[model samples]
Target chain A: MVVDHFEARLVKLARKGDQGAFAELVDLYKDKIFHLAYRMLSNRHEAEDIVQETFLRVYKSFHRYDDKQKFSTWIYRIATNLCIDRLRKRKPSYYLDAEMNDQEGMDGYTLIPGDERTPESEYLLSETQEMIHQAIEGLPAKYKSVIILRYLQDLSLQEIGDVLDMPVTTVKTRVHRGREFLRKKLENKVF
Target chain B: MDCKQASSLMHDYLDEDLTHGQAVELKSHLKDCSACNERFKELEQTEMVLFAAIKPRSITASDELVDRIMSQIPNQRKQQAWIGWIRKHPALTAAAMFLFVMLFSAISLWESDDQLVVKTADLDQVIINGNTVTVPSGSTIAGNLTVENGKAEIYGDVQGNLTVIDGSYYQASTAHIAGEIKSIDQALDWIWYRITDMFTEVAYK
Candidate 1:
């Protein structure tokens, strides 16, 4: 995304290890990066850590980063890979209560963001958001990354495929499967 | 677009990635088939819900995170290149390696003698974890006190229950208990404590 007029210049200076330029880049993208990490990890503290680590890696690897692709996409790939690595390290099984909470929220949560929506509708939409987030968390890494990038991050399927280094067809298949999985999990609930 | 084809293209249709011809076929099929139409509506609702739910929400990082990252950046260390260049020279490499080892050992030795003593007054809850837990005089526990694999020396009053797991509980002469003190050493008690701990953590945390 073209966040500001100085984005290109900032990237150039940040590549030279200019702390001020790097901080400016951080200020522009921190929220967006934090949003992606939070959705991917489902924990605020871990997401914050991922944001810091992602930028630190960006600075460290600036020499290797190409100026051809969008900086946002490159940083996102880093954050997503870090998230996938962490998720892989976790035991496939978690506390049963947490599983139960996920199941319960699937039917319970629903909240839409806009103020134009009714209070109850907004509450329901928010609950749905939580349910979707938890369900996405339960997905395998590949499916989780594709789903979050496409739906939450609002990246195109082609963009997601590029970020994940997968073919467009594979991305579509994963999206379909992920949606089907969510549909089954959320059966009987109004989306 | 039969039900079979429609089902396969449902996601693409919702994503708006279907070709114009394919979308027309799917729309035509939906118009004629009530079941397919209902299913399509449901799928469409899911797309809408997903779009509405997963927006770019903001999470403010900790105030110190930027500063912490900045300080830890390799660029911040002006001597890094100097050190790297020195490592390339065998003579200076030996000297640097010797200095690093010496400093590391000295720091380790100094750290080994440092005790992690946290007073109960300064903590919301005291979890005595080492060989012994000393509840200093005039300090009262505001929450549950747990001593694990250690002895608890309670010199002041406890507002919450005191639990010693695989440990001994010693009540000093001046100690006053507002809550029960229990020392659990048996396997059954240990299992029970673990189960309760899990439930409490799940419920409270």
Candidate 2:
């Protein structure tokens, strides 16, 4: 189905102060934005909070949203900007809430249950997941964002460029460098 | 392609962003160059692991998140509604305002209740009734004639332009005008005519 038609209608109604339309918008994008924030910040609670804040800001500035661009691009830009801001504010030592939970004796792997597997296999998978998360966390915010949006969110290079306000070539370069950085970090570790 | 060039284009190849010729060239180089090939393999593996490692779990939007956002929006939406309304109907709003000003000016002009007559007349042959000035039928005015708050009835010959302020001009069939006739209805035009007239009188004096 043509979702853009429906989304555009919702945006039109939302612009005119339709709460129900805006709520529909929230329902549509909440998970996408929440996932993006979670990947960028690696904290479920904070990601959820950021998603709420992102929508709030979107609602407040709905009048400023240019109709020339797709609504998805605009919302992604807002969410990515918020994530980048939160990342920058935590620079020098950006710690994920998962790491904090680890310190508090509740590791991320145990908290999130998954399909049935051998204990050893599950442990290995969990550790590898944590390690990958740390490698992504170790990247600078710019490269880290490109990697998250590219791989985790499965956005195209052009879409990532739009969200990051960078050119396509620049986004490609970041993706390459970000992958190389993660590769070097995972050199000795088993996948 | 040489190893150095192939290395630089490795990401483009993996992303499938290369031209067919470039991809073919890079592939040939990779077949011969194990070192570059290993590096490409490692990069590809890292990307695969990166994608795999991100657990796909739905993070449901919290009930409070919607509630909190909705709560904050009511006040903001109220403020934005006014701004949005203006943006949406700028032409309509401007037209309405223009119509209101026009109606208001018409009503005010009607309420003032002042009737005026202006004419060109010789000093010896004009009749003045408060705001009305009339030129007698047999009189001839030799110079420019200007009247304020008055109407002009030209049964006689006017040698120059007959200008009237806030009044009308009526010319009899026997009237002969040597120059133009003009009526000033608006306040600004009347004021401007008076100012120029003052300057003309000052210069002549």
Candidate 3:
């Protein structure tokens, strides 16, 4: 509901060439786009560029939006396609196991709640997060795209179908396969 | 349904796309089947953990984003398909006419960076842009400049002589003048001085 309300107001102001309203749209979706881009590219700077570029494009093309489409779905399509394009051009990983770039976007990604927790628990959580990221990254692009959209971006199946231009039945099947992949990869795993 | 059929349809079942009759049939099958029951339990646990592990995490953009994007926005002359209406529904000439009018206005209001901006550093032979120009302290423009809509800030020094077609020039205390300086604004305000000193200043200038 909050997202819907924001979308409505942003659509009105953004249609009239309002930069401030466009900036607000950036603030709203920047993190979500950044997460997807970062996961896909495994690079912080590229992800940051993707976020800004995504917003700039939305600003440039906002006037054409039909308002019938959900704003989240529209933005997800943009980010997902951009990520796919980046993936298509990237060289295959030389190594099966790549160290995650924790140093790249240092402190840019905040862990939600770690206060008063012991170091061991926090370390486990961070390692777990990294392991999950690595496992998801290793998936084939099609499967990875859907999983990240459904799990990471929190889009529903229908919304993901809209974003990826897939039938909802196909989306569900892909999600199940993706989840099974994660299950195998993460099974009995530890740092 | 046996375990295989039930497991295969688990995703559909969980999605609740199953019709009432099919759902009833499946529920009865699960009730009587042991191996299928275990599979369901396994699926339920796996679903719980996977869903728990995949909560959406928020990531923040770096603060330099605005700076980087703004820097690119300037000097960006690439024509974009605005709204795509012009290309998409070309049968509508009226829309193109409206776009042409807006484009004309934006262009007339447009200020070329080279015309208005001048760098303050000989090595600062930077272009000044806008209606007026002023060199800022401790900065250099390394190339020719243009300006359209605003003024310039020159605090440091200019490598090349400055040229501006219009607009006031504000030279700060920290400003250094290396290149030849000219201001259209200064002429009007300093007309008396300029006129009186024209003869003496003509040869040097």
Candidate 4:
């Protein structure tokens, strides 16, 4: 609660053209937004780009932000929307079933980025973790966002709804369906 | 409990969204059903693995990224400050805009209004020829004289204030006036005169 009050104060100060306050906000959410974008896009450079663009947009449109809503939710919504936009641009015909067919022909080694497979990094990400990441990368954008927000960001169902501008029931259904999809994808493999 | 009810409860349990009673029921069912128990364990393992894989990486944005974002912000802040000033002083901004528009239109109207007009209560006492109004020698006018967009020559006058708008007035050496002569050439002065004239007309009416 004290942190929430401090964050609200920072938002108020930033809205009044305080650059230092805005920098503090950026410092606070930069890694969180980057992690979200990285999970969604599976690309480090693009994730960084998303982080930059999200903060730029947030700074540009501070007046539109409603003080009643959670600032974190609003920032997450911006980051999520930017990540989705980049995903859609990467694959214009991005359908739920389309990527599944494409994944079958591709090996897991090829699915992982070539430059990211350092020996230490490979040791850090176990086979199961790598498989889970690949499965998540292949999920449809709709399910992908909810799953990441729920499991990764640890947002509540209500916070996810607010961020996605959807009802809590819809968020619940998506999270369930997303986990079920992951369960099916990882079925018959090592738990 | 049936397998279907148990599966739904299992998902709810994983989310930690289930009521305590529902969780207890699901727990009891898992104990009784081997297949449901196995399925719940796999789901729980998947949840755990997912949490491990997606847990916040120690990924921090580089100082260069912060510098890039901060460098871009000063430009936007400058523009926002200007817009914010207008937003903060809406009434002053609106009044300034209104005054600007009114001044602009008044100037345009004055420039476009070039038709010659002459008014006098005693028209018979003056000679009107072309765009010039002349009070001939030894002629006495009883009332005020106003001329617009035309020259006014007063040789002899015994009248109220003589007003010339957007035109020059010539008073001969023999000219005599009972009141002050006023010449309005600027658009702003003409507008002020028109306003006062309207108020006086309204009062008289």
Candidate 5:
């Protein structure tokens, strides 16, 4: 990714307690981080929480930032870690609770009302999106991140490696495996 | 390439990470193998769906999120500003610190030392009696003259500068000085004189 030239100046100003600069930085990254978190967690509310917590942690740990790393890499690493942590916490009892809710005809999506649509084509489009989301949500956390970062965020394999602190070769392998997993899960679904 | 290798290349090709040579090889393999060709099509379809479904959403955080984050940041203490400044300009701080130490040491040395000293390359031309030094009339000194903790009475010519520290100089009407005469009566003045003298020596060299 092309690093923003003004980003370093903003980071310097923010480090010195320029709240306006910090707010500009937040504005620059808010949507990207939100979209990454939303795709990773597949829940709007939890994704929003991840976004808030990621920036909060970034603020608290500004002193620890090493300038050698790109600010985007640093922030994405924080947001990715937060999403992984939330996913891990959702594993034991929360996982069971979610499954139970699904059995009780209360899948998480039902809580939010669907958008009004008069055209059958729009309904089909939403269904395709729903199918794609389900296929991705079924992936293991490891594969899910690589797939979302690769296709959804369009990060280069090397950039993803830096954000995830993995070797480029390892990132390539995960991306391949993740793609294969998606292909298998999405084989029969009509797009 | 075999089917397994072809399968991996297809993924690389979809990601646009394949080299031209590898792409050519994968293309030939897919042409020759129906199974791999079918599999490649499926992978392509999956990627297309992924891009079509997700990229359009462009989910954004609500406006209150930025405000909430700003609210959580504790106010930066006023006293830390200097610390931040020092952190930002370490080289400047170090230079200032070095100058301060040099000034302090010069003042302490001045306070600790009280002795009568006279410096002149042509000391033979100067007459010393007790704490008083005299350059008699019509005798010329070739170089700079420095006197400390004493009195200097000049009735002759000086070819270079004359400096008096913690002392005084009296020049007669006939005395001719080709250079500046400086008197240092305080520690601060002494320090300034030493700094300028050092710089002058460096500049001359």
Candidate 6:
């Protein structure tokens, strides 16, 4: 799961105008970054846009990168910073596109069709997920950045600290504190 | 490690960053403490669920960025020095030049104090005369009031304290002082006696 020297060489090549290698690198991280952006932003479209923007930023800044430091940390830092900025501007209650047709009923903010046969548990879980998203939304940017890097991006505590430019203790504290807060928010609904 | 330390360290322990001895100690503690062990399980599960939920969403790159970078690149090959110039944008170059001049002037002026004349007082402001740093009887201090190595006279409402370091001053009868008067004069030296002499002689007479 870790990017190795082989990938590092490929990144170096990509930075030096190897379009094919650049494309390959994009293909490699797209899904993971897409999901990261999606979970962080909660809007699929915005997440996708962030992923795209993140890649562009990566390309532009690649020349300035220090390979001694892990490239993954560098890119993940960029993505996490972007996500935090978006989250700071985002409001607590988001408007999802829900269908209001006769066949499909509204499940909270999500639409459910009569013939769609989506499991009841799925809808409930979605609502709970939405609530969790809002709860995370309420957290300060510092906590959210650490939580996202730890949980969503699957970065290690050390990696999270590297990205946040904080110590490992600070990252752990933020992650623990953020999770405890979410635990309180998701207590009745998800638990 | 006891249960308390073991549980507190479980997070670091899970990172596999602990030394063998520490990890083993925590493991031994966990075996004895069922409550801490149970909490550890819940904590691990929560970590798992959160980790599993983190999936990277695919993001599409902007075509404009690629095109823009690609376009500038061809020009770079035509002239190698051009890349350096391009990298150092006009604004940055100007800023660098300005900084260079500023630093040069700063260093030059730093050795000479004539150009660094600091105006300490205005006609309306307080003036320091020998032993006394006198405040204009009916003036206001917009900022901090300081008396260094000498005493201060508070004829007006001082917002801060009046300090007499190694010396003292008495307020005039017309004074309306608001702040405290601090005297750090340990010994009643000749200076204090001389200052007292003027008032004492007047009082005796």
Candidates' chain B TM-scores in the order shown: 0.37, 0.39, 0.33, 0.61, 0.51, 0.30
lDDT of 1: 0.72
State the interface C-alpha RMSD of candidate 1: 3.6
Q: What lDDT, from 0 to 1, does candidate 3 have?
A: 0.64
Q: Tell me the tens digit of each residue's lDDT in model 1 across A16-133.
A: 7678988888887777777777667665566778988898888767868888887778888998998888777766554233355543222111133442212222234466666766
For candidate 5, write residues A1-191 as lDDT tens digits: 24576999899888777889988998998889988897777666677789888987887778899988889999999999999999998857665554333222133553557722122122334666766776776677888888888877888999999999999888899888887887887788763
For each candidate, what TM-score against the reference?
0.61, 0.62, 0.57, 0.68, 0.61, 0.51
Residue B43 alpha-carbon offset, candidate 6, angstroms: 1.6
Candidate 4 lDDT tens digits, B58-126? 454556778789889999889888998999999999999999999899889888979888888888998
Clashing pairs in 4: none
TM-score of chain A of each: 0.80, 0.80, 0.81, 0.85, 0.83, 0.74
Candidate 1 residue-wise lDDT, B160-193, digit = tens: 7888766677898988777777787765576567
Give Cα-based local distance difference scores for all models.
0.72, 0.76, 0.64, 0.84, 0.81, 0.62
Predicted candidate 6 versus true structure: per-residue lDDT over A99-178, tens digit per residue? 11221122332333443323223333445444555665556677877787777777888888898788988887787777
Worst 10 residues of 3 chain B by lDDT: B111-120
Per-residue CA lDDT of candidate 2, range A1-191, in tens?
Answer: 48999999999998887889999998888888877887777665667779988998898888699988889889989999999898778745335553443322133432567722122223334677767777776677888889888887788999988888889999988888887788889978843
Residue A172 in model 5: lDDT: 91
Measured with DockQ on alpha carbons, how good is candidate 4?
0.52
User: In candidate 6, which residue pairs clash?
Assistant: A32-B56, A34-B56, A34-B57, A34-B58, A35-B55, A35-B56, A35-B57, A36-B56, A36-B57
Model 6 chain A: ten consecutive residues of lowest lDDT: A97-106
Residues B146-167 of candidate 3 have per-residue lDDT tens digits of 3333465567665555544355
Q: How does candidate 2 score on lDDT? A: 0.76
Two-way DockQ contest, 2 vs 6, winner: 2
